[model samples]
Target: MYLKIDERIFRELFHTYYDRLYTGFYKKTGSYEQAQDLTQQTFIKFWRYRDSYNPELSVEIQLFRKGKLVFIDWLRKESKERQMIDSLQQQEKIPVEELSADLKDSLNQAIDQLSPMRKEVFNLAYIEGYSHKEIAEKLNVSVRTVETHVYKSVQQLRKILALIFIMLHL
Candidate 1:
C-alpha cells in the first residue's frame, strides 16, 4: 500500500532532520540522553499534529520551535521541584543527622504505618526523586492517582509524627 502524504512527509522529515535537531538539543541541554528524548518528543509532536502543518512555512523551523517549547517546559518542572525541596528545608532548620535517635525511630515508624502502595509512592517521590508522571508510569497508574497517593501519605505521616511527639513528651 502507498503511504499517505502526511506519513511520507514525516518519514522524510525524520530522516533528514533528526540528527540536526538532536545536535542542537544536546548543545542546549548538555546531556546526550535528554537531547535524544527531546528530539524524539519533537518528532512525536510533529507526527501527532501533522494536519496543522503549513506548507507555506518551513517545517524545519516548526520542529525547532516545538523542541524549544519542550525544553522550556522541562526547565519549569525542574524549577518547581527545586522550590518545593528548598521550602521543606526552610521549614525544618535541623539537619537530619542532628535529629535524635528517638526522633529518627519515630519517623521510620510513621512511614512504616502507611499502606504498602502509599509507602511505595512516598519513597519514590521523596527518596527516589521521581516525578508524579514518572511514578505513575512506573506503577502503571494514572498521574492523578499517583498525586492523590502522595498527598494522602504526607498527611498521614504528619499526623502520625505529631501524635508520636506528643506521647513522647508526656
Candidate 2:
C-alpha cells in the first residue's frame, strides 16, 4: 500500500515523539551531543522514508526501529575507532634508547639481523620517525608494503630479543 503522510501529520508526530527519542538516546549514549545528533538523524530518516510508512504499524514503532539501527551503527564505528586508538597508543609506549645498555645492545643486534629492506623500513619508521605514508613515498613502494616490512621486522626483533632475555636469565 502506498503511504503518503501529510506534512502537518508528520510535524505533529515528530513533536510528540522527539523528546522521548532524545531522552532514550541520551540514556543509551551518555553524551548529550551524540544523543542530539542521533535523534536528529532518526527524524531525517523518517522524513526521507515517509512514503514507506506502514499504516498498520504506529509511527513511534517505526521511528524507534530506525533509531535503534542508527545507534548500533554508531556503536560499531566507535568500537573500531577505539581499537585503532589503543593500538596506536601501545605502539607509542615502546621505548627506544631508554632501555638498559645491555638490552639496547641486544636490540641493536636483533635489528641488524633483519633483511636489508626490512631494516631500512624499521629505522625510517622508529628511529627517523617517518609515517607509513612518508616511508612509502621515500622508498618508492606502496604504503601497505612498507607496513608489511615494518611488521615483519618488528616480529623478528621480538623473537630475537626474547631469546636474548632467556639466555641472560639462564
> Which numbered prediction scores highest in lDDT against the true structure?
2
lDDT of 1 by residue, 1-170 (tens): 22233777789999999999899889987878779998999888877777776666687887778878888987897577556544553553344567789998998899999999999998887767788899999999977578768767877999999999999999
TM-score of each: 0.54, 0.54
Model 2 alpha-carbon drift over 4 Å, by segment: 93-170
Against the true structure, whose TM-score is highest? 1
lDDT of 1 at 68: 84
Give all candidates' CA lDDT scores. 0.81, 0.84
Backbone clashes in model 1, listed as residue pairs: none
Give one digit per residue, the lDDT tens place, for model 2 in 28-66.
978787899999999888888899978888777888998
Error of 1 at 158 (Å): 7.7
Residue 5 lDDT (model 2): 76
Model 2, global lDDT: 0.84
Model 1 stretches astray by more than 4 angstroms: 1-5, 93-170
Error of 2 at 10 (Å): 1.6
> What is the Cα-based lDDT of residue 85 in candidate 1?
46
